[model samples]
Target: MTTPAWENVSDAFMRNDKPYGGGAFRIRDSEVMTLKVTGPDTPFKPASEWKNPEIAEHTEPWMNNSGERLSRSTASFIRGTLDSGMTRYFQQQAQDGAWWYSKDWAAQYISTGWMDFTRQEPVNGLAPQITRLWRSIDGGRTWTQLKWPEDRNISYLKFLDPQRGYAIGWGPNVWRTADGGQTWQAIALPPMATDYRKPRKQFDAVDLGPDGLLRVAYYVGMLGEVRLSSVVYRLPWDKAQFEPDVVLPDQVVVRLGSTEEPPGHTYSIYALSRLGPQQTDGDQNDNGKRTGAISMWPGHRNPAVRQLQTFDERYSLTDMDVGKRGVLLVYAGDSSRRGAPHQITLYSQDYGKSWKDIDDGMTQGGWFDSLTNTQYALYAYTLRKRQF
Candidate 1:
C-alpha cells in the first residue's frame, strides 16, 4: 500500500474541454451528455461537433418525474433513425482505429427521477453496448427501465437517489439498478472462484452505495496466475430478489456507499481493492496493441502488483460514484496503441474506501454514465461532455 506518485497531484486536475467519456448526469438545472463519434464519413471524425446546433435543432429532450422537459423529438428521432445503420457499423470501426466515440452522453430531469439512454447492437458480433436507466415518479416525466438483467452491458452509469444506483463493467459484470434501472441483480461473491475458462474472467469492476449496497471486483486465473476477488451485495427496497448478502474476502479495488436506509439496517455495503500487477516481460499480445496488466495472485491478502511500468498495459476499474465525499472514477488504459493517452483516474475521498488519484485529462476509449445525480461521458471518438 505504498503507491503514490501520480505525477504530482496530476497538475491539480483541470482538462475539461467538456468531452470526457460516455456518461454524465445531473438534472433539475439541466445536464445530459453522451458521445461516440467518427461517423459522417469517418476518418476518426470530430472536426468539431460538440452538439448545440441549437440543441441539435431543439429536439432530443425527454424528462418527466417533474423535472419537466419533453419533446424527445419523436424518441430522439426514432433513436436517430435506428442509429443510422449503427452509424455505418461504427463508421467502419472508426476507419481502422477500431473504435472511438463518446465524449459523454446526457439525459436528466430529477425532481424525483428521470434518466434514459439506450444502445446495444454488438452482441455475438462483439463490442458496442450501452444502456443507462433511471426513473422515479413522485409522479411526472414517466420513466421506468431499471430492472437489471445484468444491466445488459452497461459500460458505466450512476444514480444517488430514488432508490440508489451504480454500475461498472469489464466482465465479471457488476450492477445494482435498484428500482431505477428497472431491475439488476448480482452481488455477494468472493470465496475464491475464478476459473470461468480463464482469461482474467474477462475483466470486471463496479461499486454503488448510498445504501442499496454493491461492490465487486474480478480477475481469476490463467495469465501468470492472475487472482483478484471482492464482493458485497445487499439491495433491499422491500426485497423481491436482489442477492449478494455479503461475500467479502478482500479484493475490492474501490467502493463507495450510501442508499439511505438507516432505521433498522435495510442497506449498506462498501469495498475496495488495488494490488494486482506484476508479470511484465513483453510479448503477451492480445493484438489491439498490448496494454493489459492487472495480475494478482500470490499469497492473497493484500498482495501486490500495480501499474507495472505503464505502457498500454490494458487496465480497467470504473467510474463508481457516491459523489461529494465518495467519488471513485477509475478507467484503466490500453487502447491497442495508435496514440494511447486515455487514462482516467479520479478517486476523491472515501467512496472508494480510500484514494486520491484525480487526474482526468485524456481521451479516446469511452464509457461512463451517471443519471439522476447527473454526470455523463461516452467516447470511442464521438466526443461528448455534459455537466451543465
Candidate 2:
C-alpha cells in the first residue's frame, strides 16, 4: 500500500528491420509503462525525449474467473510488435522483477506476491506473502486475472509457442498451463520440507527443449547462504506430467540454450552459469564478480556441467541471449582498466563456447538492459548517459 520510491528508469527493445522496417518497445517506470516505436524510420530516442509520454486509463476492474477483484496497475511487463504486426504487451499488478512469455507474445503470463511483515513473529519463520497470476489477450490493452486457490502463491510462469508452458514458485510446485494461461493443472514434484523461516526454493528460469519438451531450471541457496545447488526439471508437452529432474552443482544458472539454433525453444539444452567462487553469505555481490561460464545438457537426460574455456576473458560478460541470429552476450568491462569501453556487446554463433565482438562504438557510458529475439530479427535495449 506504500508508494514505491521512484527513480528515472527506462529501457527499449528493438525488432530487427528487414533492411527497411523495424519496431521497438521503450520500457519505462520499472516496466509499469512503455512508449512504443513503429519502425524503419523511427530512430532510438533518448529517455529525455520521453520523460512524459502519452498515457491512457482503463475503466473496468481486471477480474478473474472466480469473481475475485484483480486491479490493473498502470505498469506493463513487456511490449513489442508481434510477427503478425500486432502490438502486444503483458504486466502484473505488484512490482516484482520477473516475467514469463512466448517470444511471439501469442500467449502471455505474469504473477504477483504480497509481503506481510507486520507480524511480530514470522509465520513458519518467514514473512507471509501471497501470489497471484494474470493473463492478457489483446496486447495488454486489457487483462484477465486468473483464479488460484487461497493456499497457492505462484512465482514464475513460462510459455513455449503460446500453447505449451509451465509454472513453479512458492509451493516449489510444478504447474502446467497449456490452454494459454486460462487455467493450470498441478504436477506433483519431489516434496521438500516447507518452512516459513528458511529460504523458499525459488524457480528462476525455464526453457523449451529441441525435442519440443519443457525444461525448468531453479536454484537453492545459491545466491543466499552460498550453498550453490540447482536443478533442471524436464516435462513433456502432452503428458499431464512426469518429472525428469536434472540436478547440477552449486552455481547460479541464468540463460539456457539448445543444441539447435534459436535457443530457449529447443531440446539438448545448454545453460550459462556464473563461474568462480561465490560469496558464502549475503546477497548482491558483496563477495566479488563471478567470471562467466557455460554449461550444457546434450538432452533432458544425464547432462554434464563443463567449463566453456573458449569464452573470451577480456570483457566481464554480464548478460546473454540466444536466437536464430546466434547468441548475444553483454560485457561491462572494468572502467578502471586503462582502455576499455564502459560497456559493449559480443555475439556467438556456436553457442557460448566462443564469442565475437559486436560493439556499436559507443565509448562513453552505456549498459545493456535486455536482449530480445523474434523469428526474423534480434533486438537489444541499452542505457547510456553522456560522459560530459
Candidate 3:
C-alpha cells in the first residue's frame, strides 16, 4: 500500500510477532499505520500518548563537531513507546559528535534498536571519535546509552544474550554484563607477552565457540601494523578472564555482529586475507578491493577458531552473522575501492558453500528474522517487511 498522504513515514519495521502478522509502524503525524500481512489496505490510528519528554541541554552536533567548540548546529534523539501506539523525541546534544537512530522489528513484548552516538573530542587539533553504545528495549520508545570508558581505545561490542554481553577493547579490555545491559562491569583481560615497544594488543573480536570456550581475537601488532602471528584467547563462559587459544596467523580479522532473532545467541566473524587489489565485473564493481578470501566461523558444532567458507566474493563486507542451522547472512557494499552506496544481502544455508541473493540492490538497512524468514528492510522512509 502507498504511504498515507496526510503524514510521512517516520520509520518502518515488522511487528516482530508471528511472521506475516501484519502490524503497525509510526508516521510523522503522531499516528500509527496498521499494515495487513496479506492486504494493501492499512488503517491509521492516532497516537496521542507520545510526547516529547524533558531532556538535558544541547551542545553537540546535529550534524558534526564537538560541544566545547560550540557551534550553532543542534541535535536530538527519537524516543517513544512502540506498544503505546506512538512516537516522541528526546533532546540531547552534548559537547561533541553525532547521533544516528534507526528502527528494527518487534516480535515479543519488547522491540529493540541500537544507535551509536559519537562524541568527537579534539585533542591537539585532532578529534578522536568516541562512539557511545546505546540500546532501546521498548522498541525504540526509549534508549539506554551504555557507558564507554575514555581510557579504552578500541572496543568490539557483542551480546552473547540480551542481558549478557561483552565489550572488549585495548585499554584494559573487556566490560561485561549479565543483566541485559542494565549495568556493565569491567573484566580484566589476561596478560600478553611483554613488547615494550608499545605493541598493539588491540582486541579485534570475541565469540562463543562451539567447544564451550569464549574465543577472543586480538591483533598482535607493532605500533598498529599487524605482525605475522595470530592469537585468539580462550576462557570458560563462567570465567571472567582470558588464556591463550591462538589460532591461524596472517589473516586480518573483520568481525561481524550477532543475529537479531536470538539477539546474541549466534556470533560470527570473518578472517580476511588481503588479496592486495581487484577489478570487479559487476555494475557495482570494485577496484583495488583489499579482500581475496573470506572465511567464516559458524555454528556451535565446529571446532573453536575453525574458519569455513561463507562467501568467495571480494565485495566489501558491511555485516555478517550466523542464523538458524548456522546459515550465513551477509550484507555487502560495492566491491569498489572505496566501497558502499550499492548494497546487497546474501544468504547461505550450507555455510557459504551455496548462496541466495536476497536483495541485490538493497538500499538502507535490513534486519533478517530467520524464524519468519522475513527481511525487515528500511527503504526511503518506509519499512518494507518483505519475504525472501
Candidate number of the best TM-score: 2
Q: Residue 196 deviation, candidate 1, in Å?
A: 40
Q: For residues 122-209, could you state the per-residue lDDT of candidate 1 as single tens digits?
A: 4443433233333424222234433443224445555555444555443444455555445566544343434554322423444444
What are the lDDT scores of the predictions, listed in order?
0.33, 0.49, 0.45
TM-score of each: 0.24, 0.57, 0.54
What candidate 3 gets wrong by more than 4 Å, as runs, is 1-86, 89-91, 94-164, 169-172, 178-185, 190-202, 208-214, 221-230, 256-288, 296-307, 310-314, 336-340, 356-359, 386-388
Indicate whether candidate 1 or candidate 3 has the larger lDDT: 3
TM-score (C-alpha) between model 2 and the true structure: 0.57
lDDT of 3 by residue, 1-388 (tens): 1111122233533333222222223333233333222211122223442233343333322422333233322223333333453233332322322222223422111211212333544454434333445565554455666665443443445444456656555443666677765677766665552334343345555665433455665455432243544455666668877765544456545553333333346545445433332222473654445543446554344336545543544566666655555566667665533443666566666646766554345454445555444445555545555433
Off by over 4 Å in 1: 1-79, 82-231, 236-250, 255-272, 276-316, 319-331, 334-340, 343-388
Q: What lDDT does model 2 reach?
A: 0.49
lDDT of 2 by residue, 170-260 (tens): 6467778767766778886532323355356555566656566667666655433335566666677776655645656666666665544
Error of 1 at 20 (Å): 9.5
Stretches of candidate 2 exceeding 4 Å from the true structure:
1-74, 77-92, 97-106, 114-127, 161-163, 190-199, 210-212, 218-231, 239-250, 259-268, 276-279, 282-286, 300-306, 310-318, 325-344, 357-388
Better of 1 and 2 by TM-score: 2
Pairs with backbone N, CA or C atoms under 3 Å apart (clashes), candidate 3: 16-106, 16-107, 60-94, 66-96, 67-95, 67-96, 80-141, 163-180, 286-335, 286-336
